[model samples]
Target: MAILELAIGFFVLAVLAGIFGARGVAGMSMEIARLLIIVFLILAIISLIL
Candidate 1:
């Protein structure tokens, strides 16, 4: 849940940065968001299986 929220926050930050023309920040945030979401999903799957 916390990871999901962090991913969402990063996604929002990426979008805002993109709007403001901060390409580097936007890219980095987007990458972070993607990684967090992937981690969250993996953890969720593991929890469900175990």
Candidate 2:
């Protein structure tokens, strides 16, 4: 849940950065958001298995 929240936060930040014309920051934030979401999914699956 926390990881998902962080991913959402990063996605929001990416959108804001894109609106402000900070392409680099926006791209980085988007990548971080993607990574966080993947991590969250992996953790969720592991928790369910255990």
Candidate 3:
């Protein structure tokens, strides 16, 4: 559930970025990718621990 939420958030952000961001789009995309990866890893770790 959390993972799905995070993915949807990432997708929405990507779409917004595509529409509005031109110069900083590359950096924004990379940062979003990194954030999503971190979120996934953290969720995985928590699930495993629980």
lDDT of candidates 1 onward, in order? 1.00, 0.98, 0.70
lDDT tens string, model 1, 1-50? 99999999999999999999999999999999999999999999999999
Pairing residues by index, what is the TM-score of model 2? 0.93
Give per-residue CA lDDT, model 2, range 19-50, as digits (tens): 99999999999999999999999999999999
Give the TM-score comparing model 3 with the true structure, all chains together: 0.54
Worst 10 residues of 1 by lDDT: 39-48
Q: Tell me each candidate's TM-score.
A: 0.99, 0.93, 0.54
Error of 2 at 23 (Å): 0.2
Q: Backbone clashes per model, in order? A: 0, 0, 0
Give the candidate number with the greatest lDDT.
1
What pairs collide in candidate 3?
none
Sort the predicted structures by lDDT, highest score first.
Answer: 1, 2, 3
Best by TM-score: 1
Better of 2 and 3 by TM-score: 2
The residue-level lDDT of candidate 2 at 37 comes to: 95
